[model samples]
Structures are given as structure tokens and as C-alpha cells.
Target: MALEGAAAPGVAARRGLGMFVVMIGVLISAVDGTIVVLALPAIQDDLAMSLSSVTWVVVSYLLVVTVLATQVGRLGDMYGRVRMYQAGFLVFVIGSLLCALAWNAAAIIAFRIVEGVGAALIAANSGAIISELYPPAERGRAYGFNAFGWSVGSVLGVLLGGVIVTYVSWRWIFWINLPIGALALVLAVRVLRDRGERVRRRLDPVGMITLGLGLFGVLWAMTGLAAQPWGGTQLAFLLGGAAMLVAFVLIERRQAEPTLDLSLFRIPAVTPSLLASLLQGLASFAVLFLVIMYLQGPRGLSPIDASLLMLPGYVVGAAVGPFAGRLADRWGPVLPATAGLAVSAVALVVFALMTTTSSLWLPAIGNVVIMIGGSLFYPANSSAVMKASPPGRLGIASGVLRTFASIGMVFSFTTAILVAADSVPRSTAFAIFVGSTTLDGPLAVAFTDGLSTAFFTMMGVMALAAVLSAFRGRAGSPQRRPDGRAGGQVPA
Candidate 1:
């Protein structure tokens, strides 16, 4: 039998099936992104990699995804989103199988790049597909449900990664994706229908190449800067990356159909929402990464234990997001966005004060606060971007928004690595693992202090985000909706 949302006659069942298919793809892709963190040590042991090299395992995935996200979104618009979505699932499954069979770190990282590319395609189009499936009135609810997949996936990644690593080999972490991915692909093909007309525009080869290379350079430099000396190969990469990025900007300005529509920056609502997303990413992504390390590395918590500790925070946030989206629908984006950022800033401060000797409640409380803040902002920010974008350009706008968020994540990770590298000794990286497992001695103090510093930096970043969020379009502005409806005005 065909899934619910297939082009079959049954409307209700088809819609439900379509939503499920989309959410499965979303959750799995997101879970894969973070699940590897808990498995990092296992991977290192298996491959005999240095701490710095191990980081590339994560960085490679992120960099490839971030760079290609916008391009893939555009491709979805030119082709059909359903087609792209199915292709993404197939590619991701192939990548997962490659990762599971990898013999070394280099091979795994290479395979992860393939996975990242697939992930980018899926992420860039998931929301666009949801919007196509649901009417405007119900779209908010549908998007809220989609966001839950992201939040739950993050938590599941940590929890499942722990479980898999504890009982199974690290390779199982990747192997797990195959069956789920295949299921998603089958459901998607059976449910989601092709919607858009295939446009036959020439691909902007120069624009695509420049943008990809520029992003790769920047992300590469950011990831490597901390591990390599300032005057060495890292610095050269940074400079080269920056120069290429400059060339990209210049090239894009002259292109008739640039991969990225630079003109979108001119839109009043789009600019603030994009900037807010970027800042939110910079401030928040590193916070979670460091927290996982702190809990599993220095606090002597097992992977499962640490995942459980973080459960409350993610649950609270995910629960509140739908309500926050409703509030945005009524009040406007500014109040919720500003309030969320403020809450996040406060949470970061609390998080910064946490030491090994501090009560566990402190960190838990801080995490909850940050999640609450994020849930408030995310849906609202997304709504604003959709409202501001033209209907014909929804896919492009989504791409831009996602690209900014991905870039923010890259920056956050890079910053965390740089800061942690300075605070923790390269040789004693294993000490962190030992202290985390034992949780009983002076080594715990050192590990906690390093974490505290990392949290402090994250707090500073969140505070900066708060300041920027306040500048989001004034309350109660008559924002233009993609559907040209005044009833969708953003509240001041």
C-alpha cells in the first residue's frame, strides 16, 4: 500500500504519511550530526588518531554540509524537492555503509563528507516540502512538529551513541543509519509528490565553485587554527580562505543568476532573521558540544548518563517550541526572539559559573534555560523569514537561512576547539577521558575549570546575540507575507 500522502485520493492519510516521512528523514539526519561526539573516543581508539585529527571527523561533515546547503536548496527548486529528497536518503545510506566499513580515520572522514552532502540536501528541502504539503493555516503546526524532530534527534544521538558505543562497536553508530535511511527513502517515494515545474536554467558554475571553495577554506581554517600554530599551515589556510571568499563576493556581484541571491540582504525582515540565526548558532552550538565533553570527559559520567542528564533540557525546549510558534503567530517575532536571546544569555552565565565542585543542578538548570530560549527564537525566526520571502523564492530563502545557521555552527565549533585547545593540554587529552570516567580526584577540577572557561566564552557569545536580537524589526510592523496577506503582519 502507498503511504498516506502519496498522490493517491485519500487526502488525510496521505498528509499524515508525508509528514511522517519528512520527520523521519529530518530526525535521522540531525541525529547523525551529533551522535558521533559520544563515539569520538571509540573512533580514536580504533583508528589510533590524535585529538586534533579526531576533530576533523566532525568538522569535515559540517564544512561540506554548510557549503553545499544553499546550492542543494536551489537544486530542489530547479528539480523536484521529492526527487532531491529521495536522492539524499539514498546517498546518505551509501555514505553510512561506507563509514561502517571504513578501515581508518581518513576513510571515515571522507565517507562522512559524502554523508554531509546528503544531509545538506535533505535539510535544505525538508521544510520546503512540508510547506508544500500543508496549507498556510496549518503550516505553523507542521513546522513545529518538524522542529521537534531536530531537538529529539539531538538528544537521541547522544543517548543512542552512548548505548551503541557501550555495547556495540563504534562502527554500529554509522551502520544504524542504513535501515532507517532505507525506510525513509521508501516512504518518501511512496508519499511525497512532485510539486514544482523543472526550470532549465544554466547552473552558475563559477558562482558555485567560488562559494564552495570560499566556504571550505573558511571552515577549514577555523577548524585547524587552534591545533596548528598561527604562523604555520593553519595561518596560510586562513589567509587563502579569506582571499578566496573575497573573490567569491566579487564574482557573485557580476553574475546574472548567482547561486546566492546577494540582493536578499536588502530585505528588511530577511536581514535581521538571518543575522539572528547566525548569532544564535555561534552562541549555542558550541555550548552543547562543550557540555557533552564536560559531562563525559571530566564529570565522570557514562555516555548514557550524560545523555540522560541533558534529557530534561531538550524535552522542556521541544515541548515549548509549538507554543512559542503560536505566540509568534499572534504577537510578532521581536518580543519572542529578544526574550529568547535574553533567556539564553542568562543560562550561559549560569553555565559559566559551573565548576566540578558545583551542584549538578546548576548545569541542568542552565541547559533548560538555554533550550527554552532557543525554542522561543527558532520557530519565530523561521516564520519571519518565510513571511519576508517572496513565494516564488521560498526555496532560496530557506537555503539562505539554513546556510547562515550552518555557518554559525561551523564558527561555534571552531571557536570551542580553539578555546579548549588552549585550556587543555594536547598530551593530557586522554587524562580528560580518565577523569571523566573516574570523577573522583584533582584531575576533575582541572577538567571542570577548562569546561568553565568554555562555558564563559559561550555566555559572552550569547550575550552578544541578545544585543543583536533586540535590533530585530520593531514590534508590530506590517511585514509582507509570501502569500501577500496583511493578516500575517508581525507584531511590534
Candidate 2:
């Protein structure tokens, strides 16, 4: 039987347990997203994978997660967030088990796709679920904690992946998920409860197809642009993807329950916050990827060392994120978000300058600054989006936000690869790190130049984001519902 009503107070004593369950799943998903990067060398040598095949290991998972996240979020709204969350855990665990048993690169990539699907389900609804559990006033705090999981997991993935691959085996990476996932599952079953009303609605099959195809096409183009000629088959996919995306927008406009709510973009507050989140994502994601390459390739650092070098930035950011959230609650989100982006822009400039020299402290300091800026903006941006969205559409809004972040990451990755490819031979491209302090050859030097260009480009984008955030602040403050609940009332 379907569980109804909020859990009784006695039952609600386990709400913390529910939160724990959600956090564990979040950590697992976040860790898996980057853990494989650290283990790639081991995996490649053990499985004798070609470069292209190894790339698939990461690409496949990302592709699956990005495509399915929004749909899964809508599903959570239609059914129950808890049910979908648990299902995600189960699917993820199964995929992990499959990944552990894989004998070849093909098998591993296939299992990763499955794992990604599970991740999509959890990632899409985790924020909304957490928001439902907490009151509007405390939502920022809750989100801060949630973001902490993501930050910690990202750092741990680098460190743990290094230790695991070095001492144990790459297989242990997947095997580790079993215990953590099981615990989360048990707690979720015992503790989590949903109070949101479920509605029956027809699935927008046309809209879904169009969005999926369009995004797939764009991502494929971006991915191909890394190694293939710009005018070749890859460009074809990019053009096709763009066209499909246009069609998707048209179809959504006509749909009764569009998979995507185009109208939300019209809201004064929603567009800016969302755009800010995307810009932040674009800068942060690209920088991390390029920095990692720079460390490993030209700097001649091992994976473990590279991971360690990046740790301070994440630690500082994670530690300060909650405080930023608290600050956002008191002041408007605009000030913090704008200030954060400005700091990030400055940090990127410093980073670009540091690449001209080989001082470890320069990059480390720049990383810390960038992270602080990111931490400050993330919670504030999220709060703004949540406050701006209609209560009835919270789940959808959360999903859209996550989707934008994912889309930004996709573009960042593609952009990083394209920049690298333009300067280096396809064979040695991945190994080229773009920084001022290190140059191995002409190709390496060119790669560094490309990296500089990308950072400058990111700085420009973040500056624009800061300006937009100020505009968002000027928009009338979010009007609360008559009952005084910020997010509980349905949209009129």
C-alpha cells in the first residue's frame, strides 16, 4: 500500500536518518562521477583499452545522466520522491555490481550507463526532497549541507581513487558502492516520507524525444570536436542537435504538460538565477578538468599527487559553504551571488597569470579563491531559484536547475577538449597541460595558450553573470503565499 500523510512525529524522529540516506546516495553519485578519472590509467593498462574506448568510460555515464535527469525528476513528482530515490539506489547498486564484474572496456561502459541512469533519478529529486522536508526559511541551510556532500565526495574521489587503484584494484572502485548504497536504502525505507500531492498527467512523449535527441546531438558534436575535424561527421551531429533542440522548444510550447516548462524562463527572477548557475558551472567544470590535465601531464605529477594538490581548494570551499548559505538568508541572494562571481572572475585571471610561471602556490591559491567564490554563489543561486519557482512546480524547477548544470558541464568538457585538440596532435592531446610554468614541446605550449584563452573566456562569462545577478536583485522580492508558506502553496 502507498504510504500516506507525513510520517507521525515518532516516525519523523527518523527524518535525520532519511537525510543521511539521501546524502550517502549523493556522495556515491558524486564520487563515481570523478573517481574513474583517477583510475583510468590502471583500468587502461589492465584492460588494454584504446584511448577512444577509455574516453567512452566517462562519456557514456555523463550522456546517460544528462539525458534522463529531468524526466526522472518529473517522475518523482508524479509518483513519490522517496520511491524514485530508493529505486535509484537499487539501480545504482546493481550497475556497480555489474561494473565490478566487467571483463572488458565495453562491458564497463555499458554498466556505467546503467549506473548513470540511477544517478539521474537520485540527483534530479534529491534537492526537492530535502526542500520538502525543511521549511523555506531553513532551506538554505539544508541545501548547504547537501552541497557539502557533493564537495566532499569530489575531493574524496580523487584521494580514494588514487589509494584504491594503487593498493587494491580498479575494481574496488565499483565494489565500494555496495555497502554504502545498502545502508542508504535501509534508512530511506525506514525514515523518508513525502507530503506532496501526486497528480496524474500524460507523459509528453514528443517533447521528451525531441529534448533527448537534441541534447544527445549537441553533446555528441561537442565530444567529437575534441578529436575529429571540425568540418567532418562531428559538425553534422552539432547542427542536427541544434535543429532538434529548436524543435523541442516548439513542441514544448504546444504540449499540455510539457516536459520542460518554457514559461518559467519568462519569470524575472528565475532566468537570471538559472543563468548564473549555468555560468558558474561552465567556469568551474572547465577549469577543474583543464587543471587536472595540467597537473598530470606537464607538471609530471602522479594521480595521487594531483588529487592531493586539488584538495585544499575543495576543503576550503566546503567548509565555508554553509556560512555562505546563512549569509544568503539574511541578505538577498543577489549580493552574495554577484560578489561570488566577481571573486571567481578575479581568481580565473590570477590562474591565467600563474600559468605563465611554475609556482605551486599560485595555482593552489587561485583554486582556493575560485572555490570560495563558487561556494558563495551556489547556495544563493539555488535559494533564488527555489524562492522564484511556484510551489507546485518545485520538483520540476529543481530538475531544470540540475539539468542546466549538467548541460553546462557538457559544454565545458567539450570546450576543454576542443581547445586542447586545436593545439596538439590527437594522440598526445590528452597529455598536454596548458600552463605558463610548464612547456614540453610546441604542442604543449599551444595547449597552454588554449587553456589561457578558455580561462579568459570564462572570466568574461562570470562577469556577465555578476551583472545579471544585480538585475535579479532589483526585481521585486518573491511574494509569499497568503498562508505565509513560501513553497507549499500551489501555483494559481
Candidate 3:
């Protein structure tokens, strides 16, 4: 019950240190998410990349992480989570170094893929690692700190990306990760220890290959559709990817140790928690891109200036996350998680109401509203999933959670560009997104209208997320223990 010991001397201190190290991992991943976006134009100019190719600098990392998260998490379950996590740090550092030294477009994209593998390893296991260290009662608070890492990292990425891209070289962006990662890697080795039981399951090569290739095919098509008009190629990839995914499901059902532990969904709380995360991600991830497009496209703000507008929200959200997580720990996940989604949906409504002539403060206020909602949702949703997961399957649960969230993120990226392009020329819409071009006059008005449409669409998605969150049952109830009992209470 509750991971071996609570009264042991020095264990609590070690756990605290371990959690701190894990937060740093979350920080690095979050920083990378936004940092690269601001530097894309400079990278394009320096490397003489075509418009389409520059976007891959961002897409490649997301794609690789999305594809490999579950498989790597399985590795964590088979080996040691701590061992794989340390390896993630090493590989990420090396990939960043390669990125800093990259000479051409193709090289940087390839290096980003390398970086993504490390990221997948880290992202896939961080939750399970936390679960191994902390018990259910405290996981919400721990995840709150995790969200805090994300908030601070998002803010840092924007500020650092802007400052470095303007005054320094874009290469420094990748270089910046080096010192942070190195320190974290050393700390990870010294501070974190594997406390969970290991499963000696055979690797599912068929499931891995099918899932990876399937996701890649669909993602490649979606990213392509975002940059250019849809065609037969996109349709073909979509259908082929769907078919492969179906085959993956069929294969998983027959396997002894399936890559995805589909049985996890049988728990009452698990399915809703995972679905809520995916839907929340689908609805919310693109808001950053959409708002940036709004500021850069119609309002003609520079990248740095636009990012600054969103900074206060991240600041407020970071501060609020721990408190909301405390509420989750006390009240169960359903309340705060669903309430957060409702709050975020309200913010989307506000965003949808904006226009070219609307006050700039409109979006600033909405950003604060949405980030607060996000702070509430992410930690609770995560806590719910991990809390319900059995000790032995924590890695699988964590991996599936990352996989769902990554899928949402990838789709949200494509949805933002494709939906906004409806009101402008496709190339023009893509240019506005990447900060290479700005719109004015009628084009600006039309593009703003498109942004409103996209906002409304996402708002609906958030509503569905709220509904799913509400259905997660009582999160404060006892979770299943390793001894086939509910928490510490034994059956009569």
C-alpha cells in the first residue's frame, strides 16, 4: 500500500530531491515547446530554408515525441525508470549540442528528432516516477509543482527565445538547454532512485512499428495540410494511417504484453481522465498559435511584443497552479478539473469576440482566464489518471497519457492553420503563423474573422472536455492497491 514506506528515515528527503529533479525535466520539455517557435524565422533565413521546411524544425520534434512516447515508457517499465530518465537527459543534451552545431535545414530537423527521443523518454516517465515517489493523497500537489515547471518554462522560453533571437544567435537557443540539462542529469543520477516494481514483459515490435508508422503517416499529412492546400496525398495518408492504427488495435488484443495496456480503461476513472486530457489539449494547445497569429497578423506586432502580452497570464497561472492542485487533493479531481474547463471555455468565448479594432487588452485578459483554467485542469487530470493506475502498470498509464496529450497537440497545430486559412490565401495564412508576413486592411479583417471561427470551434471542444471531466467519478475515493485491494482497506 502507498509504495512501501512513509516513516522511513531519509526517504522523504530523497523523495523531495527526486521530485525536484523531475520538475526540472518538465521545465526543459516545456521550454523547448515555445522557445523554438520564436526562432523559426531566423533559422529559416540563416539556413536558407524554404517556408515548408522551416516548419519541420518544429514539427519534427513534436512528431518524434508523439510517436515514441509509449514505446519508451514501456522501456522504463521493463528496465528502471530512473535509468531511462537519466539516459533521456544525456541524449537530449547531445541532441541539443548537435542542433547548436547543425549546418543545414535537414541536419537541424534530424537533430530535433534526436532531441525528441530524449524528450519522449522524459515525458513518458516523469508522471510514473512521481507516482512511485509520492502516494495518491499528495500527487495532486506534486503535479501542481509539475505544472508550475511548465508555466515558468513557457514564460522563459518566450523571453529567452526573443532575447536570444534578437541580440544573440539562434544557435544559442539550443545551447541554452545544455547547462540546464547537464545540471539536471547529474542531479537525476544522484537524487532519483527507482522504487517501483519492474515488469519483465517482452517487447511488442508489431505494435510499436504499426503505431509509429501510423501516427507518422497521419501527422505528416496533417502538417502538410496546414502549410499547403489539401490534396489526394493528404487523403491517402489519412486513410492508410487509420488502417494501420486499426491493425495495431487488432494486434494489441491478441498480445500477452500489449504496447498499450487496454485493460487500464476498465477502471472507472481512467477513461474519462485520459479523454478529458486529450480533449483539453485539442481545444487549448492551438490558442497560443491562434493568439500569436492574431497579434502578428492583423495587429502587426513583432514576435517579442506579442509574447510579452501573454506573459502576465503565464505568471498568474504559475502562481495559481499549486493552489488549484491543493483543491484537487482535497475535493477530488472532478470538481476542479471540470470547473477549469468551463472557465477556459468562457475565455474562448472572449477570444472569439475580438476583432481588429478590439482593444489589445481583450486578449490579455482572456489569456489570464484561459491559463488559470489550464492550471486547474492539467494537474487534476494528470493526478486522476495516475492515482487510478495500479502500481505495476504506472509506466503504461503514464505513456498512454502522454500519447493522448501529444496526439491532441499535433492535431491542434494543424487545426489552427487549416481553420484560419479559410478566410485568407493558404500561403498567406501560413506566413502569418510563422511571423514572416503581416496582414492589413481587408485581409486583416478577414483573418481576424477566421480567428473567431477557430476560437468558437475550440470552445466546443473544451465543453466536451468538461463533460468528460465530470464523468471521472469520485477521485478522492480509494484507488486500487498492488495487493488487489482498494488502497489500504482489506476486504472482510
Best candidate according to TM-score = 3
Q: How well does each candidate superpose onto the true structure, as a TM-score?
A: 0.89, 0.90, 0.94
State the lDDT of candidate 2 residue by residue for 1-492, as single tens digits.
122234477434455566677778778977887688778777777877765467668777876777777778888888977788889899999999999998998899899889988888888888778767755555566666666776778777877887887789999999999998888888888778777888555667787778778887887776666655577688788889999999988888888878767777877778888788777777767787677777766566667777788789878877877887766665657777788899999998977764534687777788889988987888778877776676666768787888777777767777777776676675566434221133466545666677778788889888888888878743323234566533342232
Query: How many residue pairs clash in each candidate at the backbone level?
Result: 8, 3, 0
lDDT of 1 by residue, 1-492 (tens): 112243556776778789889889878976897688778878888887766677778878887777777778778788877888889999999999999998887998999999988888888887677667754434555666666776777777867887987888989989889989999999899888886655543356787677677777767776565655565676777778888889888988888767677777777767877888888898888777777667766666777777678778877877877787666665566677778888998898888887776777877888899988988888777766666665556667777788889888888887776666565564454334322244446766766677777777777767777676677664333345667533444443
lDDT of 2: 0.74
**After superposing candidate 1, which stretches have Cα over 4 Å from the reference?**
1-13, 199-202, 429-447, 474-492
Model 3 C-alpha lDDT per residue in residues 298-370, reported as the tens digit of each score: 9999988988998888898889888987776766677889999999999999999989999999999999999
Clashing pairs in 3: none
Order by TM-score, highest first: 3, 2, 1
